[model samples]
Target chain A: AQSVSQHNHHVILSEAASLELGCNYSYGGTVNLFWYVQYPGQHLQLLLKYFSGDPLVKGIKGFEAEFIKSKFSFNLRKPSVQWSDTAEYFCAVANSGYSTLTFGKGTMLLVSP
Target chain B: DVKVTQSSRYLVKRTGEKVFLECVQDMDHENMFWYRQDPGLGLRLIYFSYDVKMKEKGDIPEGYSVSREKKERFSLILESASTNQTSMYLCASSLFVRTGRFGQPQHFGDGTRLSIL
Candidate 1:
């Protein structure tokens, strides 16, 4: 069984503040990672994903994440956040051989204008 | 871009009623999934179908059922609706293309906010 954990339950940041949301997954074998973001009253959209490649992967909306294999972590990062960046983010993991993805609880981020 | 569409954006049903939620994907995706989203709980997969008429139980499949009669449509059924089942239901689809080390990602619908009173 695979599971994901997001350390930050909620986060607040001012405009132009650097943002980093911690995500870690528990899976012994090779796994795929994904980050999804849902805006208020909108559908969940893919922020980015990592299957196999350069540990660091870039995503839409100026977001990026690094897959640290040793630490079992894939943390999302942005150099600076805008008020429009406020949204709920979820981290998900799927085993390489499986299509089912297990998602973490989620992290809510608020960017102050 | 792929378009996954849920039949309803919002629904209200009484407890014990048999509820049906429909989902359709415009793209000819090989895989479709059903998930429930709750506050602080993220999204939990209830069922997934890899092909037409094929279904697989996900992390949480109890108290719920699913039907994939056609390749483009998947339905989630609540045999006996309960208040605990009230949550946002999402439908997603993905291509089952295993191109070597590459993997296919999923595209989601707007979601149905179902309420079981």
Candidate 2:
């Protein structure tokens, strides 16, 4: 079965710290990747997505993700963290020709001011 | 802006009671989905509908049923609510794309936090 894995369950960092959240998918076939963030008391919003294109995808709020097919990983990154960036991040994968997304266990990031 | 609206922000029910959770999408999307968000579980899909009167079971649909009577409405039914069912339920909608292509990203609603006593 296809699955997504987020290695970090919880992370804490200070303001301006670099961020990297690991994500890996098990499917070997073509896939679409997505990163979603949910703020406190807010709904989930798309951070970025990877289709067939440049491996580096940039998203809102200075967030980006790189899809490395050989490693089967799509990891999210940010150069500087803000207090407002404290939220839960989820990595999802959908097989080509499918509409359903399989999500990994989210990582909760707390940016300390 | 695409808007997906869940009927209730919070709900409390008794065990064995039948429960109904309603979702409406203003985007006229072709796909609507129901998912439960739990701690450590991220999001588990319960049911999804591709068109009116068409529904498909998702990864975790054993205890849930779905109804899509209209294009903009998708309802999830809990035949017998249980205490273990207490969790946040999210509704989302997205446009369908052709095979081998990436579909439109899903838009989510402010989830309904359902608690069973």
Candidate 3:
């Protein structure tokens, strides 16, 4: 059974502050990683994904994630976050070639201006 | 735009009632999935269908069943709705890749918030 863990349940930051959300998974085999965001009153949307090749993957809205296989971690980061970046972020994992995704408990981010 | 449309945005039902949640996708995706989202539980998959008559149980499928009679529509059924089953349900769809080497992100609907009393 594969599971994803997000260390942060809630995070509060001022505008223009840097952001990093920790995500770790329990899987020994090859895996595909993803970060999804849910804005208030909106459905979940893909933020970024890591399949192969580059460990650092850049996604929409100035979001990026790094796949660190050794640590079994894929952490999302932003150099500076805006008030509009506040949302619920989820980390997900899937086995190679499998479409079923295991998602972690989401992290709620509140950016204050 | 890829569109996944759920039949209802909010529903209220009673215990022991049979409930049906409908989902339709216009992207012609090959995979459709139903998930229940709770505050602390995130999103747990209930059922998925890869093809028009092929369905698979997901993480939490004990109290639910699925129907995919058509390519674009996938339905989730709760035979006897319980008070504990009240939660937000989301429908998603994605393209089926033969190789499965690359990851395909699922597109989601606005979600149906069901309340069982």
Candidate 4:
């Protein structure tokens, strides 16, 4: 079984501040990684995903994540965050041949204007 | 846009009563999933249906069951509701792709916030 962990439980940032949310997974085998965001009063939506490719993957809203296989990490990064970027972020991992996703305790981001 | 619609946005059920949460997807997706979201817990998969009549138990499925009589619909059933079951239920649909980026994103419904009294 694969387990994901988001170290930051809550993060507060001012508008235009750079953001980085750390995510780590405990899985030795080949795995698929995903970053999902849940805006206020909205359901979970995929921010980005990494299957097998270059380590760095860019997602919507100018968000990007790097998959570091050696560190067992896939951290999400954004150079500048807007107030609308405030949301709950979750990291998920799914092993090959397994369609079900295992998510970590989400990190709540509050961006102040 | 692919739409996944849940039956209700808010529901109140009494303990020991049978409760059903319904989900319908417009896209012809082969996979449908039921998950419960709680504070700090993120989303826990309750049940998932790959095809019609083919249901699979997820991480936490001891007290939950799912029905998929049709490919476009999946229903979550709580045989006897409990206070612990009070949480936000979400339904999502996805296509079968190895890379997981073949089809559109996993569309989600607004969600059903169920309160067991």
**Which candidate should be chosen as best, given TM-score against the real structure?**
2
Q: Estimated TM-score per prediction?
A: 0.96, 0.98, 0.97, 0.95
Report the C-alpha lDDT of model 4 over A1-113, residue by residue, as the tens digit.
78899999999999999999999999867788889999999988899998788999999999999999999999999999999999999988877776677889999999999
lDDT of 1 by residue, B68-113 (tens): 9899999999999999999999999988866432236789999999
Indicate whether candidate 3 or candidate 4 has the larger DockQ.
Answer: 3
Candidate 3 ranges beyond 4 A from true positions: B101-103
Judging by lDDT, tell me the better candidate of 2 and 3: 2
Which prediction has more favorable lDDT, 1 or 4?
Answer: 1
Q: Is the docking of candidate 3 incorrect, acceptable, medium or high quality?
A: medium
Top lDDT hit:
2
Q: After superposition, how far is residue B55 of candidate 3 from its true place, in Å?
A: 0.8
Tell me how candidate 1 scores on lDDT: 0.92
Give the runs in model 4 whose Cα sits over 4 Å from its true position.
B98-105
Report iRMS (Å) of candidate 4. Answer: 3.7
What are the lDDT figures for the candidates, one per model?
0.92, 0.95, 0.94, 0.90
Model 1 scores a TM of 0.96
Candidate 2 per-residue lDDT over residues A11-103, each given as its tens digit? 999999999999999988888889999999999999999987999999999999999999999999999999999999999998877788999
DockQ of each: 0.55, 0.71, 0.65, 0.43
Give model 3's share of reference contacts: 0.57
Instruction: For candidate 4, list the clashing residue pairs, or say none.
Output: none
Clashes of 3: 0
- For B1-117, candidate 4 gives per-residue lDDT tens digits of 789999999999999999999999998998899999999888888998878999999989978899999999999999999999999999999886755333334667889999999
